[model samples]
Target: MELPVRCFVKAVRRCFLSYICLAVFCGCLMGIALIQMIDGSFKMDIFERKQNVTKPRTTTLETPVHISPLRMKELAAKRANKTDLKQKWLNERIERLNKAAQKVQMRREVTARPVEPSDKFHIFYYAWYENVQYDGNWQHWNHEYLKNWRKLDTKVYPTGKHEPPDDIGSNFYPSLGCYSSRDPITIDIHMKQIRDAGVGVLIVSWYPPGLSDGAGRSSDLIFSDLLNAANRHKLKVAPHIEPYNGRNPVNFLTHLKYFVRSYGNHPALYKVKKNGKESTVYYIYDSYRTPASSWKELLSPKGNISIRGSAQDGVFLGLLVDVHHKHEIKRAHFDGFYTYFASNGFSYGSTWKNWKTLSVYAHKNGLLFSPSIGPGYIDTRVRPWNSGNTRHRRRGKYYDVGWRTAISAGADFFSITSFNEWHEGTQIEPAIPKSTNGYTYMDYEPEGPNFYLNLTNWWVNEVLNKTVHF
Candidate 1:
């Protein structure tokens, strides 16, 4: 045991070499055991090489493997927390995007130029004109010639003579003849005439898409052209909603949305100050067809489809055909009232004497009162049975009387009965002295062709100059 230092060192080296070899042998055994456990190939090869090999004995261990349920729950909770955070981030992002879009829209509305003034005169304009060649056939011009038209006709017709443009169904004949609304020249002429007359707004007769009055064709296609012309002449346009086939509050709300989305940005679309907010104006003709309850569903502040204080909000002016309509309009939450009939004594509201009372009622209820006036009314050629309702022109005195009455009544605005409703003989558009096929057309007479236009300009100036505190 007490040998030399070199011999002891050599023995230590040999012992280390033997330990290394033993470690290598154990590692090789572990690798082989792992391979045998992972793959059944070793046992299969053994069985194939020695078909007489016996099965090995197996032994069981007493120790049992354990897992921590608490640790598993902690891992699941961490994963759920990650998912919730992701979802929360996504929701916040969406909310932020929506808010940004709202801001942009608001900014656009704020930045838009104010083209329409708070106080201005408006006129009811008809755009339901068509040409026989372009429109495929004679339309409203031959309304009296259709089947059952004779039965419904209140006027006497000649045996077999039906003249168009000059001696058509309407009592009044247009100087420009029967022209299409889509005609650029006609639109230009209309815009110039309206502008020259100092009318700030034109409430165009409008129906839902694909719908039109029984006698005329649809004017929806010409709206854009009309707007373009109006813009060029610095005139604003409001929609006069006519009765459609199936119009309800819910559907009307959709129509309003469509109008706003389509033309709200246009400079020519008429907008006015309403309840401290600038909004578009819509004149609803024959709105009583839908009940006040239904209208309240959209017009009232607490309505389900209310546009109050929203960007798409508007001032809806209901037709006031009678005195009782004021109460109905108030109940329906309309913004204003307008008399559409040209005949002065036709209705309570249309009569010149009742305007002051109606205006007083409107003021009490904080509603706008706009009285409609016309030059004259004579539809004998169209409704001979109703000739009693006709009011003679009296050489422009009738129109002057209406203007004076409207001015005295303290109207918030003034509306002309029509610019081109020739059927009712209410059109202030120029009429020519025409004689065709034994039918003689009436003319302005004594005055030039621009008589009514000049009269309108004078009244418009008066309206603009006069100031009322209320």
Candidate 2:
């Protein structure tokens, strides 16, 4: 066996080699198995490098913005100055108004007239509401009757086709005046119409007096018109100052001059008798409110030009005293005064009895006196009436009675309440009493003469000419 073992030494080496190879193979297989067991992933790699960092930079705290004290003070001073300026403006305005008021009061005291029945008393009406002016545009005109009336002739009024209606004779409204548009054409036309119609004198309305306010501002506008009208038509213009306003004296005087200078020589300018000097007619609405100061200023010796213009020779100034304020007669400052009443008011019933007494007083004072009459009152449109105060028939029974009473009192100049005041149910035209038609706010119907016109005609024959026909 020993000999055999020594002989197989090489063989044994060979066998050992074979064994090592087998072991190597087994290790390789194990490595492959481990790789398969675990999950594998492929990734894209990227690399970026930045600059080196330096020491942190230091920063300083910021100071807040501030406003200077001087600027604040400057703003406050500006505001105060503005306030002072406004106050000064208001003070100046008030002072001017006061001075104007004082001037008017003074005039009323000196130039007032007393009533004289023996003198010629004229009846007039304010017919402004019928002013349908034509300013190139027909849309501004409101009088349709004017167009029809104008077709009659140019002798009365040559005003354009769109001119106002000459409705004063039948449908007059008290809201109109000749000076409205500052255009002399209207004045000329108005005067011509009055002259052609045989209207002796026009009793126009005036304001800025005690009974009226700034309504008198437009008075001057018509001053130039009055001059033109008077010169052309010999139509007199009598401005009736309303005693309701108690306006500024300075303003009134200013108007006074404008009226006199512009129409001084006009043939239509009012004349007191025949050879009087002045060419103006001043009619006060009431005697009571004629401010004493205004009277003194008008007739004072200071020689104010305005007073002289108004008081020059031909002037015939008069006053109208409403029954409501008749008590002021004792203190009235005027050249001539007249008595008028509102029979529509319940109080008028009692006041009617006082007409005789007032007439006697006016006659004794050497003053010119006139009276007014009308149908019962019921101004339903302007002021509504209750059941007991319904509108009266146009020619109601009371209308004739009222006329008789006025005539009996020797009322030479009688002013009918109105020509066409439909609101008062006193319109005689359209035959209020017998006609089926009630009222036409402004329309004119041939069938009726309107209550005012009826009364006017009556006065023309009975009072004005002392003759009555129908």
**Which candidate tops TM-score?**
1
RMSD of 1: 28.1
Candidate 1 vs. true structure, TM-score: 0.70
* CA lDDT, every model vs. true structure: 0.80, 0.45
Off by over 4 Å in 1: 1-119, 145-163, 467-470
**Candidate 2: clashing residue pairs, number:** 56
Per-residue lDDT tens digits for candidate 1, residues 169-256, read: 6766788888777778889998888888888899999876677887576666678888889999889999999888788898888777
Each model's TM-score?
0.70, 0.48
Clashes of each: 0, 56
RMSD of each: 28.1, 28.2
Candidate 1 lDDT: 0.80
